[model samples]
Target: MSDLEKKVKQFIDRHKLIQKGSSVLVGVSGGPDSLALLYFLNKHKEMYDITLTVAHVDHMLRGKQSFEELLYVKNICKDWDIPFEGVQVNVNEISKESSSSIEVIAREVRYDFFQSVMKKRNISTLALGHHGDDQIETILMRLTRGSELKAAAGIQVKRPFATGTIIRPFLCVTKSEIEDYIKMNNLIPVYDHTNEEDIYTRNRYRNHILPFLKSENKNVHIHFQQFSEQMLEDEFFLMDLAKKTYNKVVSKEKNGDLTLNLIEFRKAPFPLQRRCIQLILNYLYNGELPKDLTSIHIDSIFELIDKTKPSGQIDLPQNLKVYRSYDLCVFTFHVQTKKPYFLNWDKGKTLELPNGRQLFMKEGSVPDDIGQNIFILDENTEFPLYVRTRKNGDRIRIKGVGTKKIKSLFIDLKIPHNERDVWPIVTDQEDNILWVPGLRKSIYEASDFTTGEKVILQYK
Candidate 1:
């Protein structure tokens, strides 16, 4: 009946955030924003027939304070009679394993936990506590990182994330509104000290960039928010156009590489070309694709495509390669051909490559003692593994054939020269060849299947 309730109702209705009797799993951190969210959503339980859950992630970065925060959140959920659950993760280990920052790792681990809970409970909606402040901070951060107009578009009210839909009912609401609600309702939420420190990137935006922008314009947040919404509209149109253009110009080869028609892409406008490149990147490389590969990167790709020789290769950041071969711009995973990235391959484990990447290996059988890495190695296998880029002197033997320089082999194999650098090679401690990971193994090792060798390598 109050104005806040009306506003919440309007937001959910405008976004169609949930259906009547729909269940939402809320990401709560015992912070003011999430606490206020729980209060309002719970208050309207009857009208919407909504089922609510409070899920918290204890990052364990703040020592005892982190545990206390979790307990506080648990108690709050108890007071409201809401279902409460949480998970604790060693974010450092995850960051190291995934080659991601702690911020990214925490998000991944938290979302993984949240989705598992949602799936088990048959929940359809995942509610985040992000407000206008978070939105402005995000935009500023993206901008600082060289995001263009379309990339600077405001975050959506609701978008598909993880297994289900993630809805932000507070996009229209400012941080002050959430705080006022908490203050008026006597809400007690834990304050995270990290938010005050500029150690994290987001904190830098929150602590400095936003305040400076506010000081200069006084209405910078609102202006950017509006700008974002408008940009979103434009982006939506561009993406649709890109999709149409992509369908006309893009095809897939039998080898799973994307083939973009150079003539068609060159014919389209620059924006369309950029969008098409983005689309190709998104579709070909699955799982959390960077929505914003720089214009420079895109333009570089364009230049490569425009002058691309048959089977020509271009390398972009994040290990993305654009192959201009066979009259198609084949977007490929930027795999090092010469030296491969190292995965700690022990006696018993599957080393998962970056998502959706298939490590191409030469046809082979394994001896029983030879490890998965060295499919056909004898007892005299190399150690202290060296995974590096290709050197000039590298050589490999062809089965029943004599040895040949690896360089000549690649050239003969029609491997795009730029792509040759991205293929990973594995070596032993003595710097001897063990495997050309995802490709051919060096001839120093025997390919004849011997005892204790198991050769079952697969990509999923």
Candidate 2:
């Protein structure tokens, strides 16, 4: 076997990228790297006991040139007697119709096509041609763009995709090695001119940063691949720990709010704490993190937990609210500002509030024991009672203690800021605040032995 073949064979065996009798689909772009990968896989197909199929995407960015590359790959597959699958997509037009760039749209289209083909053919593996140099570029680019450590780990060699797994057998070899292989095999691979331009970030790293690094260390790509593998391993272990820690310290409410126990969260190491926050954000965002979410937002959460103040809040992108009350911190996508509403209550009727709560009013004998969620009013207390949200400068008269601001009451009760606006406030026709449901009641609460009929208000 040739040196290149031996190296790739060892790498694949080490990673267990392909199983015996596996059906492998190769993504061929008619470039040196991909073409080399295709040739290598086909040459060793029988030895590995695997079936090979070639898949190509004509991005239609360069008009006829792109289509010709697709044709070249298809013809090569025909000559080798390998099954071929190809698609033509107007990526430029798609980009124009959406907010995504051409590069982003092209990658999405290519991957979607590859996944569809894999699913249809029941393929067990999709092999790609990303090389060691590509790994180095991806790492540097992500780090330069302020990516977190997990993201900086860069492209993975093997990961789960559509119906099976996507494997990168070329990651063990450098771009120069792939070029050398192509030349030795007498293969004619079409090149994309755009790859030579510096306008793209990856090209910039490849054209300028890569040569400098290679000059410093002839085998830098190997060290980078080692670094990437190590980082991924470490990240995987830490993230597993973080997920366990999260399950222990966080509880999900029925309303889709996440309540984390700060006391328990702080018991973990700093690394786990950071990852727990990331896990929370990922869960809350349903795995698609907002672009604006960064380390700064995470740091603010840590600050909120560490602060001496018992209650505080910070707003995040996409209407996410993170707040702390006592030892509990909540992450929710609920709206912070509730609309102010004034709802009138009729006797023996339930009024549905905008905040998904019900307020019921009735005339009956006052109970000796009244809970925070229940209020009793004097029989002569005025008609047309109202249940509305708190207004500015709203205060309730507390027996013997005089009047207190609703805002102060909320603060004293440690109510979350987002909930205070929607808290039900019971009042009389004269606009006299009677009670704050599930909280405090006013001085007008009647006694059980009162001579007249009493009004009972219950909030649920």
Candidate 3:
């Protein structure tokens, strides 16, 4: 067996990439790497007890040339007696319509075609020809672009796709090894001229960075592959830990809001803290992170938590809000401005406030003690009291503090920004602010409990 073949076989075995009697669908682009992988898999099909089917995509970028490349792959499949599937996607048109780059659209359509073929053939394994050099370039590119932790680990050798698994067996071999194999087999492979151009980021990395790294160390690809594998393994273990810690420290509400316990989260290790934040974001975004959500947002969350102030908030992509109030951090998509509400309090009836609190006014003798939530009014006081949300320029008279604006009271009490809008405020018939429920009572509250009949206003 050739050294490249031996290396790939060992990699597949070590990773448990394929099972015996598996139906494998190979993605071929008529390139040297993919052509070599197809030849190697076809040569050892009987030994591995696997069936082979070829899937090709014509990302109609080069017009006729791209279609011809697809035909070449189909012809090769026919010569090898392997089943063939091909697709044509106008990647340029799709890119324009989707506002995505040509390379991203092409990759999306190619993978979509590959998965369709796998599902049609009931294939359990889908193999791609991503060599070791590709792994190095992917890691470097992601790091340069400030990708998140898991993304910086680079392309996984094996991951779940559709109803089966996608495997990259050639990740153990370098690009030069694939070229050598193609030459030894006298194979003719079509080249994409775009790959040689420096317009694309990956091509620039391939043209310059790769040669420099390889010159310093001939086996640099091997070291990079090992680094990728190690990173993936560590990420897997840490993510598991983070998930468990998340369950302990994060609470998901019925309305899809997330409440994180900063105390318990801060107790966790630093790595797990970052991962827990990632878990929260993943849950909030339904596992589909927005493209613009980079590590900077995650750092912002950390900064919010570490700040000495007890309360702050930061807006994230997609209208999400991260609020830190005291030891509690909340992640929510609901940032609707609370509508100002004003409701008249009918005698002997309960009024429900917008913040889910109940307020009632009843005629009775004053209790011996008045709490912050209860306000006693004399019979001669203002009639037709009202309960409403705070309005601009709202103020109340305190016993010792004199007049204080409602906004200043909320700030002094360290109320969360979102809650300050909906906090219930009590007013008399003349629009005079009387009491801030669960907070302060205005000086208008009847201090002489012994006088005549009394009106008791209590908040629940």
Q: Quote the lDDT for 414 in model 2.
A: 76
Each candidate's lDDT (Cα)?
0.72, 0.88, 0.88
Across 231-308, the per-residue lDDT of candidate 1 in tens digits comes to 788888988998899999998765566778877777888888788877787676673566546577777776777673
RMSD of each: 12.6, 3.8, 5.3
What ranges in model 2 sit over 4 Å off? 250-259, 284-286, 318-321, 324-335, 338-341, 361-384, 390-409, 427-435, 440-458
- Between prediction 1 and prediction 3, the one with superior lDDT is 3
Indicate whether candidate 1 or candidate 3 has the larger TM-score: 3
- What TM-score number comes out for model 2? 0.86
Candidate 1 C-alpha error for residue 107, in Å: 0.4
Which sections of candidate 3 miss by over 4 Å? Answer: 286-294, 336-340, 345-385, 390-415, 425-460
Clashing pairs in 3: none
What does the lDDT come to for candidate 2? 0.88
Q: Is candidate 1 or candidate 2 better by TM-score?
A: 2
